[model samples]
Target chain A: MQGDERGAVMKPLRRPRALPGTATPRPRHRADRRPRSTLRTILALAAGGVVATGVALLASGGTYALWSDTADLAPATITAGSSTLTVAGVAEHAVEELDLTLLAPGRSVTTPRPVAVANTGTTPLAVTVSTIAIPDGNAQLAEFLRFETAVDTGGGETCDLAPFAVAALTGESASQPPVTILPGEEAQLCLRIGLTADAPASVQATSAVFSMIVTGDQVRVP
Target chain B: MIKRMSGTLALVLVLVLSGAGIGHAYWSAHGELTGRVAVGTLSMTQTGVDGLAAAFTTDVTEVTAPVVVTNDGTVSAPFALSFTGAPAAAEGTGQSSGDLGAATLVSVWPAADAASCASVPAGDAPDGSTSSTGWNAIPPLLGTLEPGGSAVHCVRAVIDPARAAPGDTVVVTSSLTSGIGSWSSTSTADFGQSFSDDAIVSPHSF
Candidate 1:
């Protein structure tokens, strides 16, 4: 009976009865269903292959050139150059305090020791008066004070206060006309500080304390 | 799947562009130095006063003193002279109410020498004499003096015989003041404090 039940379950799947008066039913093979399933599998594999190809092209920087030329040039060992600016033998990031006593109204005083701005680096630098920090209490004195800068080119040139006009320290942070120094070279900077003749009486016997920051930037040559 | 791949590509491109934007840097070096400057001073000194005291009588009623003023400070300023004090009668004279100060005439003039200052005659106004009664008079500016400069001035006083007794004695104190602009006072000594100005550059790394 189990053999007969197995044969009954497989009989319709193995062969289907044709309609009446139709031609004799052709024999159907199990291989007939394989073509459709094989085609679907191939389509899925093709889609996956296309996606993978796209990802490969995108990942390789999208270089579409099929041919490229090669050049065998000598490699360069770049030695990074340095930029250093020093004032009075003192390097940057350091503070030096100078005392300029006996400043009188209608008179100007120059630094006894000329400020030496030296370029100790490997590259040329452009030096400039960057920022001036005047204490809030001495702001009034700053108004009456005049500052002048001159570059001494070693030709008997001196710091002349008569040529000093309205420049730095007159409510301005920096002065104009930046001085440039070559590598391993130094420049003498003369600063003349003058108290105007019309300075008020309140500024007498008072002190003005301030800081000046000078900056030197590396000059890049094209 | 293609849409998702495009989204991934766009995100990667954004990251690459952002990395390129922050690649720039600069090299700079700076030095900073501080400066301190103190203003000079204005002052004068009464170096000498010759014959400041004198006895007066009805026959000889005028006296003169040579006051020497020197600018001892670092600046040039004008100097002025002012007098303060009242005249008093001699002790036990019972003439305490005698008003000799009211009747005395005080005058100042720039003199060439001490001898010439002492020789100024009574009842005669000398050249450049600031003649006035001591009461309610503005101090006279003698002259401007540069640093270490000196000036000699004669201070003469005369008594009016009609307004005072023979024993009345007037002692006057003189004050010397030096002034510039709005600042005026007695002499101020130098503090002798020293200060200086300087600057430095800053160091920067790239």
Candidate 2:
């Protein structure tokens, strides 16, 4: 029985015969016409444009640059302000030179050798003084001599500090600038040099070159 | 499919033209900053000065003379001063190295305008006072020199009575200069160029 039922379900079905007039139904009332029109062309073009625009916007996240440019900076001419520091008052020039010649223990030079610090530029600067690059081939003499700095600005101006230890006078690290000088202004420094009385005989003939350095850091131009 | 392709091509052309049109309105502006910095010079002078016009004699003690240094430039400068005024060929009859006698010296700057300078004692200045010239350069010192920063010097010139007899004469001079002197600077001098930004071409910012 099941085999018979399965054969019936699998049996092919046949279409009913169409009436003569219905066989070619669409042939009736047909006329000469184009499959596509100008309207269709316009519609296709619109669709493509929409798709292209959507893709562009989606890819770039709706961002576009109008105009951009970059230019390098022009070369600047920097007129460096000069810090003119000169030494004065010596025997070659006056009496100060003669007093500094002999380097004996307990020897002291109290005479003022005015070291003038000037800001010879169009700007102001913070000035610092250091005894740097002082020729010191003889370590003994360098260690034996003690130096100090004092200041005198014109009318009775005096600054006396403890003697700077020769050993402590390393690089420019020991310098301190407590003053600011404007352009065309100047300050005078009175230098004092001395030899340690306790220095041993080892430093007898040793010599050392001496100098004071005045550095200027330019201030904002007003 | 062909119609769609044609539409895509048309859209692409439109987008390209629009982009070109936007760029056509592109504008540009320029900004500029300029700097012209020239380092200034540091100079000083000490000529035709005096150490007490009271005259020079055997009885005078150490006194001070005033040295006034002026900076005529715009900036401050340091000067390496040296006492270059040795006796130059001795002038006339009073020209003698030991004529001024043995004397010790010290620098004294008292007050701004006043000096504690040394004199040639009582009596008369050297008969060749006009002949003795002071230095144009200062002794090179180990320090700073500010612009217009001036301090009067009292070059205490004290005669050593034990080393000299009366009636002798002496002549000396000194001055100041900026920087150290090698064989070149002390004896020689050398001499630069720049163009302004406003010279030519378009008026661009500087």
Candidate 3:
């Protein structure tokens, strides 16, 4: 009975229907409709890897010139003033030169003070200087007194009174600059003395003994 | 794929850390304790004299300081010497000539004036400033001067005896600089040479 009914229903269905130009529809595919797990995983992983690579490149790309600068502040300065002399500050100016002695005697000759002493002190002080030193390890008052005097426009004079052959500064005196401060001072009442000239041809034998005695208590240099 | 990705990420991180480490190291570097005059003979002779002294000039004329710059360091360094009135000599040419050079050369200045510098210290770093104790007028520089290399600089400065005193000193300074280090040398000469009223260019026939 099933075959007889199927035969009767297929009689019209078996007949060829002709249209103008349309082709017959192919059979539908079940496999094409299914989801692909492997492909999905691969694409997700590829996208993640690309993102990671991009992040890495940004991290290492450019260089920034990171630097720091500082102002080497000029050291505090102290100058010599009038009757009132206050020890304001101190500074050091140093220069060093080296020479090759291949042809002659290769000696590192240092001409510490080639000229007269540089004007290291700040304030203008009218100082009448005398030479006092300890010669041969003994305190003595030398006879020769050399005074380098320059007339000041404001009645202020500076002199580096050196007794030609004295070596050390041992004792304190009223005529010379003071070596020690009384109290309430940061540094001693010292004068700014430097080697004025270039390196000397021959180093002088005599050591320098400057006995600085500040007369006025309130002298401050700019 | 996961393994490859992990490897690449690890490599990238390592590179970044390495670069930072280098920069930090260089920034934190410090200097190691390494490191390290004459005058006269200035005169000129000319025909005819001014009415007073003699048929020829008889006054202190010029101050010439002949200097030899030597490099004593173990490493090679480059150097450049600058002056106020003259353009510096080109690299390897130890002398400057003519007015352009003379403009950069220091002429009339006090011995203690900061404008007269002679030799630049040896170094590769840029000075950008002058040394406090060095020759004063011109700013200082440390280009590069090789170690053990020596350069000579001469200043032919004429002074008028009528105006310039005999005992006065004319100072010239220069610098020799190398990698990160510099050396300054100065020459100061007393004024006592033949005088010519007019400015004469001496023939540096070397």
Chain B alone: TM-score in each candidate? Answer: 0.65, 0.48, 0.29
| Per-residue alpha-carbon lDDT of candidate 1 for residues B1-206, written as tens digits (9 for 90 to 100) | 45545555565556555644546566787876567777768878874443545444555556677778888877777887666645444457645434456666778788876678757666786876887764235265467887788888887767676665644444455677876544555842110000011122121111
Where does model 1 exceed 4 Å of error?
A1-65, A74-101, A104-127, A130-212, A218-222, B1-14, B31-43, B47-50, B74-78, B84-96, B112-116, B119-126, B133-139, B162-171, B179-206
Can you write out model 1's per-residue Cα lDDT over A12-128, one digit (the tens) per residue? Answer: 664557779989865587765567756766665566556655655565456678899999989989999888888877863322333434566676666654577888888878887
Minimum summed lDDT over a 10-residue window in model 3 chain B is located at B26-35
In candidate 3, stretches whose alpha carbon ends up further than 4 angstroms from where it belongs are A1-222, B1-58, B80-143, B165-167, B170-206
In candidate 1, position B62 carries an lDDT of 65
Tens digits of lDDT, candidate 3, B98-192: 22222122232112212232332222111333222112454443333454555543333433344432222222323333322112333322111
Model 2, DockQ value?
0.02
The second chain of candidate 1 has a TM-score of: 0.65
| Highest TM-score against the true fold, candidate | 1
Better of 1 and 3 by TM-score: 1
User: After aligning candidate 1 to the native by TM-score, how far in Å is the CA of B78 from where it should be?
Assistant: 4.1
lDDT of 2: 0.43
Q: Considering summed lDDT, which 10 consecutive residues are worst modelled in model 2 chain A? A: A86-95
lDDT of 2 by residue, B87-206 (tens): 222336645433432333323333335422334443224331321122223234333445567644444444454554433333343445543111111211110001112223221111
Q: Give the higher-DockQ candidate: 1 or 2.
A: 1
CA error at residue A43 for candidate 3, angstroms: 40
